[model samples]
Target: MNQATRNVLCMTGIKKSFSGVPALWGVDFELRPGEIHALVGENGAGKSTLIKIMTGAYRRDSGVIEYDQKSVAFLNPTEAQAAGIVAVYQEIQLVDFRTVAENIFLGREPHRFGIIDRRVMNTRAADILERLGLQIDPRSVVGSLNIAHRQMVAIARAISFGARVLILDEPTSSLTETEVSVLFNVMRRLKSEGTSIVYVSHRFEELYAVCDRVTVLRDGRNIVTRSLSTLNRLELVCYMLGRQPEEVSKGVTAFREQSQNILDRPVLLQAEALKYKKRLDGVSIEMRHGEIVGLAGLLGSGRSETVRALFGAEPLESGTVKLEGSLLSLRDPHDAIAAGIAFLSEDRKADGIIPELSVRENLTLAALPNLTQWGIVSRKQQNELVERFMRRLDIKAASAEQKIHELSGGNQQKVLLARWLCKNTKLLLLDEPTRGIDVGAKREIQQLIAELAEQGLGVVMISSEVEELVEGSQRVIVLRDGQSIAELSGEQKNIKTILHAMAEGADRQEAVGK
Candidate 1:
């Protein structure tokens, strides 16, 4: 809140380019001594690039970094950490085989007379965990812990370095509401101790709740830096999206008469009392043919978990999934795919595409078994199928042989769509499919979802973009804490209605309670 105080970290004219494409263009950023500064923008807005440069993961083409009023250049992450800078990324990179204590003190383990001190490290880990208000056994394997616990471990590791400036990138993306509150409490404690924090997240509600000031970037350029008190949620979104909230064109939301007819169709996929460990809890939902079902929930509301369960990526401990009047047991992704179900994950870079493979190869990956002739792939047949869907979906690619990583996010998403379509899939589980793509591509994908449903393909789509969810889905299934809370169908399917269902879980509880 004190504008007169000197900045703890400041970067001026920070510029970076990837493959000759400019990612950050003369960006300016500043972090005060003890304030939570948020970096927000739509995907490809240079937030990650800026963080990478600051954390020594990427060298800036041109920039001046001033930390504690001394110009510094970090040669590597080690050097950055040595200089009291640590970044806790959204996608946590930790060795699962290692124990929590080992991960917390990785690369900087305590040693006594040439012997690694496990007892000392575990004691330190316990102390750090206590500071964060997290309760976990230090000797527990990292893989055994849930996503939220893993994130806390990452935070503890960052704080263990005694870093003055900490970067938290989408820290609450995979965490439950309770876990998020714990994280916020940790941030407050850190801020109180004069530790500057850089918070990056897409969820705007969190910005006002936790951050002190926010910096908006758009198309690799810094747009504005404003205090949280100076901006509202809509204004902040408008800034990050590079458009006026009122100027951005909204899609047609009016439901047609034929939309109601979709409900009368056969129940395509149904789950009863779907329960998965920490992620999903007693969730149940049903979808019908010619229906685009929207999974609506806040961050960590088990929206994606529910879809993952349906797609068979995450096994359900206790539940029955019936597809088209057939009781199905899907243990893995292949099983779900064989049952004519396809999943488009939220984290496209990690789960959706194979960067080393060509667009055609990625598209035909799931359908390869069918395309093979006597254990040999028919290139001619593969090319034909790829070309057909590429053309049909209007996927802009230099050629089918082009590497998927080389294409834009939108094109890559289209290629992913082609993957499922090529498989002759009947049900599509889309988790944040439009996320990180451009506006034009977002609209195209939305239209494609509608078109696919019109052709009688069942869709269960999850999106943080409320407008997209409301417009793309005919029926909305709202989840709260991995449980189905409300089903908005027929004339009640709208953004307002879906938000109500998502925000108020008690509507379903009231009915059951009665």
Candidate 2:
């Protein structure tokens, strides 16, 4: 390429290995000036390895990297930052003991006579926050701010570095819908100022919303690079998975094929007006056996809180839950488990997986008491149970002894699902079951959910995607401002119908909910 049309950042023949195992095999990536480039693939697709190499976290075994018409080798992140390249990671890396202003100008504080200029630093920090449309105070302590604010602060800190090229890894993982819009605005503003951004995220919608171009990686090799507007969602998924559109697109709504007669079926769970602080004002749910009931709502509308209340994780002020004609506890999670209730939380890394434990250990963790006989556990029985679920779920792990953290996001999620299936659980609450997984793994997990429900397991699922709720659930309960405002089923169980209730409140035109 000529100098006039040369890529602002280019890496050719990039190769890296960990312990002699290939991570990136001759990966080629190019970033044009003033563009939002998306780097995406399934877990273990070497996306992170490439980004780390760019930021000097991991040295490439062999490669050529050109930045701004000059070949450069950065030995550390400090050098990379000095060269006007900064990365804001998924996990916020900042001192919680300091203020937002202090964290933003941590090393390069504007100084008068070499002394720290607190006034000038705070003013500059405030200006940066204003530019990003953040309402946060510059003097606010980082520890006291909420996760969304902390994430914004991390972005602001990166912006303060005068970055010519910025990398954002899962930046919206902790953000709300409105916050995500603000972040996108900031990104667009930076792009207009001739800053190249490399966005790494598993969320496809976000890529379609803001990304200009995308590069797909698979099995440590570059698969395809194309303008996102040229490829549809199904086509993009196909490239990332190396599958034909017909093969991967089948059975997307296969669960709806099974007939569900909710009126005649026995009720597995009957939650009566559950109240949890302000989040759940009075949400009620009725899930029948051999059926999947969906909870639909916007953020803070109590979709998750209702499930948590049913699982006994959220202590309700006043509510009653019945499981098979017996009153289930509304205070203790252990009691809920003993009563044959299983809950898979939305944030798997935070509430679900025991990262340091082995696959076998994590699988059998909740069932340990049952597996133990007279205060002593049988290793043979535990191993058999673990092996059975692993095979059933098709979890891709090296061995039963492999650490849970080493597994991919999809496999870890499957292991968590297996954790409950190993028990004699009757009612399963899955919150965002397929979030952050690849198309192939997501399809597998969705198929598994359908199979489990077909086997007579009562399921109550919550998904942010309207399509998933309409297709997977027999009926949907739409919540708004902590109340179950509408119930949709039969001919009314489409994406538009459900979204209307969740967003527009049905305007008293629809019949009252059950």
Candidate 3:
């Protein structure tokens, strides 16, 4: 059969915009029956916009969407789903408090005589999960399940809709290697059954392993589409980055060069055998005065937990935290802050910022005590501090009174950074600092991190991006199953070494369990 005949989904001349800015311009995409097509791009490459258009979450300004050999315009996600098109995003959409079976058949439960049929729904949900090779109980609450299981439930729910075209956007970002393999197997089975799958991820290895064809998008336009067998890793990266492989390598090396001289700095902070319930087990780490230490691991590998324990967000069961060789007690964030420690949480919107507050308010929230006189804030002193930080951080805000929510993601992050800097923090704990921001902002933030380290601030960074971890840190601590498994330093801090350490740690843990 010809390609046109086998195409299950075809998008042509797709044009979409937001508030006069074009996100996708004349982008064309196609998915063949029974084939796993990969949609690859850097952040803001219009990948999500195009996917939203396809799934009817967004109305395209102009486009032709052909599905199942028929031109169709879906009015909403429900319409798209009814037409056999389903999308499973990175963030699971299921309700955590609800049972798996209830979530699966939510809003469309089996009914008899105006009453819900729980048994029928549970049986069907269990069957769907079993078919996907997931052993989770249908009656189990989603909140009690692990991230991997939650991902499986999302996929199972998609399948339950009798979807012919499945769109997975970063489905395995939080999953372990074993869970990824299981997801790949499920995708293969769906492909064999003539379902078209659109797999979107930044991980090249995953795309190469499961996808038959690759489509690269850049600047809201389609760059090229090629078969996986014909394109090598370097070629794929070059296409996505629009730069030569040598240039990319040089960029990485340049970032690495900044951290080469910080190895001999005096120890600034140390955690000895930190224990925090079941999340952290004797996790010990040390940071020097002018060094950045990266924590590398999978989603449930205790990277976030380690930082939380160190920052006193989560109470440590047993541990000794020392600052400059003196043992200290960090009973809460206030104590940590008093000791010149600052933490920028991973969820910026949820934990880092108060959206309704102005930039000045959010920036000065932490350092209010210092800026206050008696029981009231000294406006004169507060103005001086906010202005200094705004200028120092180059935060792009209309004025100090501008709402933080009105600023771009990058600027909001800069405000958060300035909050800690205002307090004269000696150590900064940055968790996924560059996430959800654009490329230019990411580069600026990374450069700022390096500059801060040069100024003698100890930084403990945690990022899901391996490139950031490799380029920004002088040392990386690999964690697995709540334990500090390995530490990579100097020349060992490369991506290959970190991945190898993680894999080895997983193997050793498996052996011990056996």
Best by lDDT: 3
Better of 1 and 2 by lDDT: 2
Model 1, runs deviating above 4 Å: 1-4, 38-47, 88-162, 169-189, 200-211, 215-258, 272-283, 296-304, 345-365, 371-373, 376-419, 422-424, 431-448, 463-467, 478-492, 495-514
- Candidate 1 residues 240-344, lDDT tens each? 544442443345432222365875789998889998875688888788998888887765678888888888888889989999989988898878888999999
RMSD of 2: 7.7
RMSD of every candidate to native, in Å, equals 5.9, 7.7, 6.5
| Best prediction by TM-score | 1
Alpha-carbon RMSD, candidate 3: 6.5
Clash pairs (backbone) in predicted model 1: none
The whole-model lDDT of each prediction reads 0.83, 0.84, 0.85
Ordered from best to worst lDDT, the candidate numbers read 3, 2, 1
Task: Supply candidate 1's per-residue lDDT for 123.
Answer: 99
TM per candidate comes to 0.72, 0.63, 0.69
